[model samples]
Target: MEPEAKWNGSTEQVEFSRMSPRSQGFTKLPGQKTCEKSVLLFTFVLLISVVLWGTLLFLFLTRFKKIAQDVEKLQESCVYHNDSGIVTIIRRLQVDQWDLKNDVPQLSKAVNKLQEDQTTLKSKASQISQQVDRLQEDGTTFRSQVLNEKNTATQALEKLQEEIEKLWTEFQRANGSVCKNCPKDWQLFQKKCYFFGNEPKTWPQAKFACINLQGRLVSIKNKEEQAFLTQKANKKGSWIGLRDLDMEGEFIWMDGSPLNYSNWSPGEPNNQGQGEDCVAMRANNGRWNDAFCRGQQEGWICEKLATC
Candidate 1:
């Protein structure tokens, strides 16, 4: 096995074997050189891409930061303006509230005063109404009293007028130049003055009283004269001039006149025990009756003719 020994042509194998790995790699095959060139070109392109990307990122960051700062300032300005507006609104609202508070008590006091005045007015109105009613009552009473007084005064005035008329009549008779004027309390009828005596007297006394007065016992001539004497006679009857003193049955007048007209009652002149001698009007109708001449008292009617 040790017997074989060989020799190269020029020791080429020995030099190649002796070369370093880096020297070996430097020496490439034909295809390997092409691959290496390709690799180098790829690496160069990647480095250029990374640099371009970084530059674009830097520009974007700067622009974005500037925009953010501007946005922040704008937001601050807006917030400040909004706060000022809110403050103004709040101040206005507070002022309004203060004004309302100040006016509330005054309004309430005014209302209370109005209510009190209304109450006072109501009381005064009621009092005025009552006073009016009282005044009306007083007026009614005064009117009634005035009416009564007027009625009484009217009656008194009428009575006084009647008395004045009577006085005037008396004055006319007293002052006039009448044919047959009557004295006080005497009445004139036709052409004669007549007196109706009030005192009770016997026939003789009655005759004397007539003579003193320039009159005689009434001698009724006719129906008219009888009616006048009857009207003047009292209710009990009054004595006339007719009597039967000179004769028992014959009747005559005191003036010496015969009995021309006689108005005798039914069944009268019976002489009644022979004492009835004088004639008197028995009733208001002028009926005649014989009465006692001397012993009995009687009213008498006297008459006198006119001398004018």
Candidate 2:
């Protein structure tokens, strides 16, 4: 039997497996609305434009805010640097005033001592000159008489030179060659006792003066040694065992060991010289610098070998 049809519905059934029908019939097919179509297209374009504008605005705002923050950070950094610069200047000026106040008296005393030494040497040299004049007269007289006598006098002249050297050594020993009964603050170590009082000195002058006392400056090797020095230091500032670098511009101890200190001041041993050659401890106990040998005061330090 064939399929039955119902009221208000189509009864025909169509099947097209591999072909198209020439005509089709339905209750009614809904037509596409042209006004609605135009309205949908316009809405899509409006949404796209809005989305594009919003994305661009968001990106622009983000970049502008980041740039503004960077500018503010740069201003803060500049301000911090300015404050630090001012602080450093103030500290330096105060140090300068303190140095001048203390250095004047100490320098005057040193000058006086040097002047006395010069006077004594002058007197001694004058005496030697007079002796030379007399000897020359005697030599002239002897040479006229006997060549053998002048030969004997040469030995006598050598003896006199030796005696003069011995006397000079003895004089140095009496004055500062030995640290006898030094104060507790300036305790002697290995025949060298230091005074950590006032101003920096070139390594050469410090070493040379110390050697005159039959001693050298105390050599610092480690942390303990540096601590001992710091303890004995006078807050007034003084010379320590550090010095100008050797030929290769490498820092070394007086005994020629590599120099490494336990305590150092801020930015120490910068050797700010166009080409530095000397170092001295600054008024601030732990500070140091490389400087010209002559421009600054040759600070005083007395060194004397210990009595065995």
TM per candidate comes to 0.41, 0.33
Return the top candidate by TM-score.
Answer: 1
State which candidate has the highest lDDT: 1
Give RMSD to native, each candidate. Answer: 31.2, 34.9
lDDT, candidate 1, equals 0.80
lDDT of 2 by residue, 1-308 (tens): 23344321342332332334433323233444667788899999999999999999999999999999999999898778876797688789889989988899999999999999999999999999999999999988877768656745753664465456446656777776742444454566543455443445555666666555444555565676456565665444545445554463566555444676535567755656555555554553535566555544435344333332
| Cα error of candidate 2 at position 202, Å | 4.5
Q: What's the distance in Å from true for residue 156, model 1?
A: 54
Tens digits of per-residue lDDT for model 1, 183-265: 76678888677888867788888887987886678888888877887888776677788899879879998766799999999
Quantify all predictions' global Cα lDDT against the true fold. Answer: 0.80, 0.60
Which regions in candidate 2 have their CA more than 4 angstroms from the true location? 1-186, 189-202, 234-236, 260-262, 297-307
In model 1, residue pairs whose N, Cα or C atoms come closer than 3 Å (at least 3 residues apart or on different chains), thus clashing, are none
